[model samples]
Target: MKPFKSYVVRTNEENQVTHQVEEVTESFLGEGNTTIAVEYSSINYKDMLGLQTKGGVIRNYPMIPGIDLAGTIISSEDPSLSPGDPVLITGYKLGTEHTGGFSEVARVPSEWVVKLPENLSAKEAMMYGTAGFTAALSIAALEKNGMKVEDQPEILVTGATGGVGSVATQILRKLGYENITATIRKDYQEESAKEFGATKIWNITENESNGRPLNRREYKYVVDTVGGDLTADVLSKVDEYGSVAISGNAGGVKLNTTVLP
Candidate 1:
């Protein structure tokens, strides 16, 4: 086959960032038991930040920046993956430390690749991406921490217009959660969040406060994708002894709050 094109994020020996969308020969691909002809890749947040002007996401030089990919195996020696097998990969440092999923073809370790499930197609799998995965993790955390439909109060999902929030709302609704409160940044997303099962929607910046140490209880379980004051505020609003699953740092890092009795 001819040379394949890839968007490689390179850092020099001094840890300087460089990005290049160029063609590469197939021989340069990492060696693995399974060689896949990549068909689809999703641009998750990690992938976006990793391919920057002065890339801070990449640890090694000349690495491709993609965290998720779905493709068919072109060659494989492993029993779990044979030629023509459809597969998808996420996490496992595929894009961060290793040559990633952005190329036309990829050679991934068989252990890291998952055979596409019966009901899922390659395109469908990529559509969910890492955001959906995080949402699943958040819901799982909520469930493990004793969240139930009988909790009366709704589940609060912050950053609701983003990828994780949207999917979590859908999943919670599908699981029969009666009330899902979505907190988004835009007024337009209020409608979308409602459609995704949010019975109530709030803007991220709409409710201004005087940094109260505690607030009225509103949520039973909270999925916070935006950290900082938002997380602190959610902490105050959660029902007594309730739990929260938090991910993301787009809001802020240091949280300003005091634990209430």
Candidate 2:
């Protein structure tokens, strides 16, 4: 109804990308069945790339960049939601192809809104955001693929200090898994990894491969947030009948390894 503040990223005719906080109206929110009072939003890797001129994360110019948001509904055409209902939205083209949550207000298709769990607050929801959701999804997928904690199976979480890995580790611990092994790129991350419930830490640089197509079986389950050579190497070390849930590709996209593992 009134002009509100929004952070906008625009590419000029010169192809230079710039971001600024500016005043906008409800019309700027674009089409949606629901209008929300945005309480919080979190920055993710995609959001960072969206600010770069050539990041390619943004499908169009003059966009908002946050990928995760949590807040209250102001109005909704969807009967399932009410004006004061607490809700959250992640993924689904928010902050990329759509007017996102980096504003005082956001409007999204009601189908995209998720009612916040009774125990979760908007701020807390944002604290978990997309990374935590991805981590939980990875673990759920691993469980669906036959990963179990009853035997105290060894679980490896790559990028243990990162957003997804850290959340994954804690969730595993909360689920009563004890043999959680975390992989990190630096020695300095050891303490933080352990704090996130890693029972052991493996430094990537220290674990050079022996050049074998397959290595000794180590972990029964792996949450691989880092891709590239690390994934190739780790796959060789997973035990027979093991499962690896690959998530992020912060390292690289290529997977150069044999199927023997």
Give me the runs in candidate 2 sitting further than 4 Å from their true place: none
Worst 10 residues of 2 by lDDT: 207-216
- Residue 196's lDDT in candidate 1: 88
Model 2 quality (TM-score): 0.96
The TM-score that candidate 1 achieves is 0.88
Clashing pairs in 2: none
**Candidate with best TM-score:** 2
User: Which candidate should be chosen as best, given lDDT against the real structure?
Assistant: 2
lDDT of 1 by residue, 1-261 (tens): 688888888766776677788899876666678888888888888888787645466766678878989999998889777789899999887787877888888887888999989898888888888788899999999899898877655789888888888889888998889788899877788889999888888876688555777778878898888898888878878788788999877689998888671
Residue pairs in clash, model 1: none
At residue 89, give the lDDT of candidate 1: 92
Q: lDDT of each structure?
A: 0.83, 0.91
